[model samples]
Target: MARDRLHEMRGRVAIVGAAESDEVGRLPGKSALMLHAEAAHNALADAGLGAKDVDAVLSTGRQTANDVPEYLGIRPRYLDNTQMGGCSFIAHLQHALCIVEAGVAEVVLITHGESGASRVGMGGGDRFAPDTPPGQFEMPFGIGGPPTRYALAQARHMHEYGTTREQVAEVAVSTRKWAQRNPRALMRDPITVDDVLSSRAIAWPIHLLDCCVVTDGGGALVVTSADRAKDLRRKPVWVLGTGEATCHSIISQMPRFHVWDAAVMAGERAWAMSGAKPSDVDLAMLYDAFTIVPILALEALGFCKPGEGGAFVANGRTAPGGALPMNTNGGGLSYTHTGMYGMFLLVEAVRQLRGECGERQVAGAKTAVCHGTGGILSASATAILSTER
Candidate 1:
């Protein structure tokens, strides 16, 4: 698409409501679908609306798109079940923009619910069949799960960029400081770089502290035209820009180990569409599936030069009261990671823009950049949100 056309779509749609399920982290009682319903109801109630007002619905996970509306009692005109992994919710926001603008849907609700920890109501399937790419190409070689896959990227980054273990540990240490101030954070205890470095190693250079917390939770958002958002219950967080990109699906097939090319592409498009630079952002909600993930994101998203992400995040640069406040909901590292965490990123960004985050709020924050990664560095989505038009 032309640059002018992309720019024209900025702020055409807005998020009027954003919310999480009644409770997050270790909810053994609530099934996956129940979490979805709870979050949908909470989001709609937050928007001062109801199921009857919704004309569209989007969701991911084991449940089908139709299952979401069926459970919520919302017979929608449109439904989307685009599952790209953790970043799916951010991509859904981008799609909702087009749906509302094209008159295909007036009110769209994008939801995410996962029983990642409890495994309640989750279906079982052969993730890697013998004929599948992972099973055929990667799994036979003893490539297990995310920890091992992400460790390869981290090891290469360290080898190439001279990124030190301490620098990577700083990401966890600094993010923990932010989590300490968040009441909703699951692991809010203060942690130092030394603590992170000393934690049990999950994979080489990736400690237990570096990985995101495994929790059960759900979140939802209500998207509509900016005009309609004006009369909503909460202040509208405008969708200034949106972008999505995908690289290789399997970890071994990533374009480059040192840099996230997908994030670079997605961020550039978002920056162009929003007409905003890194300096204009008041806060950033970068997906932190692992400590190294946000370090790579900083460089790819233009917050810093390539190979300088490690140094940039060192010494409390992204912590509370720092120059750049990131992952204010304590991130997936300390907050909650219910399989796909992208929805929580949007929920926190919307709340921060609305000044609803009492303790960890970035004072006078107007613009936020929410970026999410799906799969094993396979997909990326960037969304620029602001309180302004």
Candidate 2:
């Protein structure tokens, strides 16, 4: 895979450093941009570089009005603000690579943070585009927000394939089981499928536990060309391939009962570009915006058949000590969510490939696959990373 990948692409780019700020359910004291700057500085320090070494800045627009770097008091030779919601992290990786390969930047700093739970008084008053089809077609119908929109997808998945509440709960339960081993994970309470099933339902077919936690946290990663990575402290994990795909924004626009085509499309493209197969992945860091998202992504990524995602993870396939370990850092299900789960996905994959994870480490994890979803399953980005030099 490494040989074919390098032969196919430009000079290799490596994820040399990664970092995260303190995570909490809510933090009103520190703003979102502060977290981003902290994570960015730590990431640079991890890479054995100073802010002065950074030549590029790639940031996601925070839920707040100000941009991330504006608060950090730092700028770079390159700047990219690609905002597709959560997938921004993975998409930024692609854009950063282009900047580096084009000699526009030498060191690309990608950062993200969110105080989504702290925005209590300041309402999210109409963040969507006025002409956005989702707002016009769905918002006026008392459709609530992303939680309810995903609930409709869950119901449709259940209707098309005889998936049960326990199957969905299985995802939540399995994630919590893993979270117990992850010290940084937020919700570490021992949980069961019954507990998840019995948790208060946020929307029909979606329990409170099924929905992701609102979190205040930040994540950052430093990307540099392979020539420069050898000078860094840790072993470099090459971003072998990256791909993105998207469906219509609204839940109504997607085909009823058809799970995310974007994930599969991007997954296939990444695999083909990197010359990696499912069997080659030692670990998986799939985005877990909701329990259902990873369940659906597993099937789309060819971990199982279309209708077998629930049964695929049944009897502890995705749980701790399972065949293929997923979200070893607890994931969005249990770990810091910070609005964009995509950064977590990339960070976890790098952690695994670098052999940084302590107890949850997948032994001999030379290669890994990470998939991230943005919006209400509207878009997806897939990446295959390898430890091979």
Native-to-model Cα distance after best TM-score fit, residue 264 in candidate 1, in Å: 0.8
Q: Cα RMSD to native, each candidate? A: 1.1, 3.1
All models: lDDT?
0.92, 0.80
TM-score of candidate 1 relative to the true fold: 0.98
Residue lDDT tens for model 2, 1-389: 43333225532788998987756567787676777877888788888888878888888754432355566666666778777778878988877777777778878899977776675323354555557786688878877767788887778888888888899888888888888888877799988888988889788788889988777877899999888898889788898877788876667787544588888878887777777788888888888878888888888899888878888888888777788888888888887787787888888888888888887888888888888988888888888888883
- For model 1, how does the per-residue alpha-carbon lDDT over 246-315 read when each residue is reduced to its tens digit? 9889998999999999999889889999999899999999999999999999999999998999999977
Best by TM-score: 1
Q: Model 2, stretches more than 4 Å misplaced?
A: 1-7, 63-66, 120-125, 129-131
Q: Candidate 2: TM-score? A: 0.93
